[model samples]
Target: MSQATKTIQEINERIRKGTAVILTAEEMVDVVRAKGKSAAAREVDVVTTGTFSPMCSSGMLFNFGQEPPLIKASKVWLGNVPCHAGLAAVDAYLGCTEPSEDDPLNKVHPGRFLYGGGHVIEDLLRGKAVRLKCQAYGTDCYPRRELDKSVTLADLKSAELLNPRNCYQSYNVAVNTGSRVIYTYMGPLKPGMRNANYATAGQLSPLFNDPFLRTIGMGTKIWLGGGTGWVIGAGTQHNPKPQRNERGIPLTASGTLMLKGDMKGMSAKWVRGVSILGYGCSLSVGVGIPIPILDEEMAWFTGVSDADITMPVRDYGHDYPNGVNNVLAQPTFEELKSGEIAVNGQKVRTVPLTSYALSLEIAQELKAKIEKGEFLLTEAQDRIPSK
Candidate 1:
């Protein structure tokens, strides 16, 4: 068998045994290219391997000219090893094994667990039950209030802190009426509430459409509501955005609940409630590629022409937005070395040597960790155990 085939087989075996594994950018790129872009894009749900590396000093240049690619394959296997397993069994994959003293790759600390790509793929295949946590805080952003002004669990429920609608309302600005202070929500204020100018339960319509509010109340008895209270101003204008919950649901529960009539301190404006929005928080942002994984086989045929293949070809010329020629003319190592290519106006040779060293270090660490069992598969039973 070819060395590549052997490597793939070994990786698969480790995954079957429930070990952690890491895939090099080169290995990942090869697999994806082999499977075709459309197929690979569809099969791989999340791409997170690049997050750990350093950003490029040269804005337009791809960090590592060519390196291992990280991918969450459509198969369940150990993260530390490469192997062929069905996509359904991927959840068992875990991150690199615990870092050791001598490990240089361990130098970069792992942040929050971002479960997507193969992670999400595994979840879908396994049909896992997910839960979200909800909590409350004051306008000043203090989670817990002072003793005299201490908020209670009962106060939270009574004031509809657990309500989804109220919890998700955006409170960009704080409402202050001399000494009458009102808490602010997370986002922009709702239109009805802003125009009403009065702190009334009826004005809390915007909260009704917030998904953050509904997510926190899923399978729970929580209701969230918040809006700008009446603020006396000489001539201040209040223009609230059209009330539309981004997630298409209120943050509060819509179900009926029994409440005591004599519940005290249940002020509509002062009582801030919070509920679960959903399983995960969604974000919109721009991402950069710190490494480029080129298929050696394809690269060989494409010839050497490194003119910044990392940059999207469409940006170079309008006619070649998806042109095959534009793609082919991309800068290669030969072009870069022969003074035929320039990145961000600077010749490739002018690029700092430290950058290459760092890229090499990153590649070495990733490979070593995979070999040493850094990324492994998590047991499905542990995430969502069978009854």
Candidate 2:
């Protein structure tokens, strides 16, 4: 194996001299394949990886300035969607899938909403007025029981795009093998694996590019919501001890990211809030990370390809919504991307839930910013544990 270390100074020097090269995670595959990992590592400075997918475990916090008459808000609504308002008066945390209490779906679809937290968030970003309602118990010295107002994103004291979980380290596949279609956060999964929805960016995923927490940790610079952001820490459910290949890459959902960005500075195109028909709301988040080429060993890991990665395709049939009780088939990403795979002795079609086009665009954008010196590489202030 190649040496597994390089100093920040040496990396910066080569970067400034243009001798340091950067490649998209996709491009690194061929570089490592053709020139070998060591040579590629010696020539590369950074590898930009990206993923654009709908993350259900995402939301934002907005601190609307205190309402008049000093109401200690006991309830709140944004575009008819209820938000967590247990904080100070006018403060709320909008969950992406939150639905309106009086949602028409309660009568029609029974468990769905036409406009949800995602729609409300986008409407706020568009400078549209949102109907706000709050109810507070009457109190002496405050003496307010109710308030109805129209609010915009600008009317807030602080609007933080705080997503509890933005990026999953690795995503394998979602399958439906029954005879009936099923609703899922991955969109509707047709029965019999008629389509397979794979969400990761494959070779261009950041965590997959750097499986070990060597360069990516707290305070790592990243492209988030179309602007510069930083990784706060390993997100919820992060399992660094998951199964790995010889290269130490996790074969399942092993790592994740906790991220925060300025809600005002974000673009709707990159950080879109979407509502899937027949399903709930979700955020289509765009994230990009630049992994440092510390040494040939690191570079080899960064260059891992889809062909080398494998994951189990579990049944998303009737039991999926409640639990995953069966494994249908295990296939490499390459096989899935081939548009077909075998499961239960039947050839099934494949699909992708994540947007590769958007992911590729984000990677390119970060690369340009880095090359122009507009974006600087970051050193992790806190390291992620492998255990």
Relative to the true structure, how large is the alpha-carbon lDDT of every model?
Answer: 0.22, 0.79
In candidate 1, stretches whose alpha carbon ends up further than 4 angstroms from where it belongs are 1-12, 15-329, 337-354, 377-387
Model 1: per-residue Cα lDDT over 41-132, one tens digit each: 33322111211111111010001011122222232222122222222211122112111222233234332123322222122223332221
TM-score of each: 0.21, 0.92
Model 1 worst lDDT window (10 residues): 55-64
lDDT of 1 at 309: 19
* All-Cα superposition RMSD per candidate: 26.4, 2.3
Encode model 2's per-residue lDDT on 1-387: one tens digit a residue: 455667666766766766667788888999999999888878888888888888877777888776557777788887778889888766789988887677776558865556678777777777888998878886775578887889888887877777777778776578886798877777778876787777788778788788887888999888987877788998888887887878786767778888887788777787777766667777788899998988887888888998977766777675566775455667887887788888878887888878887898888888877787677787899998765
Stretches > 4 Å off in candidate 2: 1-5, 9-20, 102-106, 138-143, 318-325
lDDT score of residue 378 within candidate 2: 73
Q: Tell how far residue 172 is off in model 2, in angstroms.
A: 4.1
